[model samples]
Target: MAEQDTVRVGAFTVGMAEAEGWVRRYFDESRNREVAATGGRTRPYAYPVYDRFAAGGAESELSDGDLLAPSLLNASLGIRAVYNLQTLRPRLEKGLAAIPPTLTLTDAAARGTLASLLTDLFGVLDGPDPAVGLGLTTLSKILHRKRPLMIPLYDRRVKRCYCGDSGDHPVEPVSRSAPDGPFYAAVAAGIARDLAEQPVQWRYLASVAPADVSLLRVFDVVAWERGGTRDA
Candidate 1:
């Protein structure tokens, strides 16, 4: 049979078969062995934040310490503490307030809402020095913790591996010049479509909550793994 044709989802174009292959590769033994070796050191600090929000806590409940700690330790992005939390906290609260309590990724309005929220959040720490602002990787991590299914962690590895030439570089913090909402939305929608069409691949993420394991995370894992191999 001829190779499957490509389909566009947001900013990503992926073949159905190719998407399945990527999903399968994530669950391959060698990959699991490597992930297992790391032993998920960040989960201890991260999962509580997810649980808090999921249990109906307000978005304002998420703190700077809660947001920055995991990213500094687990994201491997070399993020530094430069911004005053007092200055940054209110901006985060406003951005989080803009996000709806429930997000439906399939809806255009919902996607728009998310995109705007990200843009507002990214703009919070815009500064004279690029390195001084909240990094894109850290922003994604904070949003992902708040809504794992809707947001994917965008780091140097994932962007380089999945976003081709259009993706942002790891060194750049998200700003007006490098807004990331649309690209992330596209990738998330593409992954959601793949999972909807092929339920079997969903089984590969059996270890996590069914709600938490969306295409965004799958793509993150695949890209992170590929990027790691290339670095090695």
Candidate 2:
């Protein structure tokens, strides 16, 4: 009998076949789709925006141009629709400026700093303006650009895959007053361990993923593709 090819993802053990299948599916849908399944000009892929952001230099401090990074990736169309750029600018500038440009999820020494940055970013969504559209998903997208090696994208699907939160009872938007640091810190730690423990698996996944994508991003694609339907 053949040994099962698997890797640990947070609390779940995922088969390599399943993970790779999702990665391929994601790329096809994002990169190769000529039309939406529903039929329209296929929405733009986020990678172009990512490339543009990188071209400008992925600095620790937020720049006017860098704001474009988070808005393009997800289904939301754009972050600006929800967040007033002027309202978000100051907080984003201060919060992101504190994060080290070189930080990665695997760095144990920088765990506290990572958590602190997440906590501060989450505040943008929870701040005084109830109309502001920012959420955990957008905050994560922004951080992923700034620290792609360290931050994983955390959309509804990724949340479903990792947290086991299903569509029926969707995860609630986090309150401003909630302590955000510990949860994201734990999430980052689990991903760190997953990447650290499975070198062979990571290498295979990386080799198959789109060039220039970060390890964290490759995992995010795999996890989001899994959704809540499959534990693997």
Candidate 3:
């Protein structure tokens, strides 16, 4: 069997053991409090907007205000970007329409579909620096809320953590130079495998979200905690 620490999905490899350790540490009382302190505060409008979508809300129900709410919230959390809702409205509507409410993480097809969808959305932005255009983190948050179970958040910390890069040498967005379909699929598969193989770890996450916590969300917490500090 392969080592639990090293997970290889296609050409991409992740330090699962390090991520697991962070998850474990994050559950500790003192550590949990410390990490929670650094976490993003809830934006009142954001939750309702997300809840509406999660409850099978139609794409037509989404407005420019709905899309911009999360982006503004992201800016508050220190993920910076300038989004023109008026310009991007049509594209955002198309992208949201592409998302099936029944999407599942366990479905192999979902990853490729999501990656293509993200690429389309990311391509809609007009900016000099692709990195700063739509903002990878902001996009991830939007996707996560849209499909909480299927999409994991991909901020600077999570990207750096997964790529094993230093803050001084941040990695590029997965969609910048190439289609990130395979890469996103690999990550989704890896996280699903980890959760399946480790029931104890999955159970540990119940302390974070008792009733319903997606494995993608668990990975998000681990990545945020680990990446914000240092490489494990």
Q: Pick the candidate with the highest lDDT.
A: 2
Question: Which portions of model 3 show Cα errors greater than 4 Å?
Answer: 1-61, 71-74, 77-83, 109-114, 126-133, 164-176, 179-200, 203-208
Off-target runs (Cα >4 Å) in candidate 1 are: 1-58, 71-73, 76-86, 108-111, 127-133, 166-215, 227-232
Q: Mind giving the per-residue lDDT tens digits that candidate 1 earns over 74-115? A: 653233543443356666677666666455343423345545
Give the TM-score of each candidate.
0.55, 0.71, 0.56
Give the candidate number with the greatest TM-score: 2
Q: List the residue pairs that clash in candidate 3.
A: none
Sort by lDDT, best first.
Answer: 2, 3, 1
Poorly placed runs, candidate 2 (over 4 Å): 1-4, 28-58, 77-85, 108-112, 126-131, 164-177, 180-182, 228-232
lDDT (Cα, tens digit) per residue for candidate 2, span 128-199: 554355566666776677777767778666655445343332223342135444455545555676677787
Task: Give the distance in Å from residue 4's predicted Cα in candidate 1 to where it truly belongs.
Answer: 8.2
What's the true lDDT of residue 107 in model 1?
A: 46
Candidate that beats the other on TM-score, 1 or 2, i.e. the better one: 2
The predictions' CA RMSDs to the true structure, in order, are 7.0, 5.0, 7.2
Model 3 lDDT per residue over 84-157, tens place: 54455566667656666566555533345644654555455434534344555565665566566666667666
Residue 135 error, candidate 1, Å: 0.8
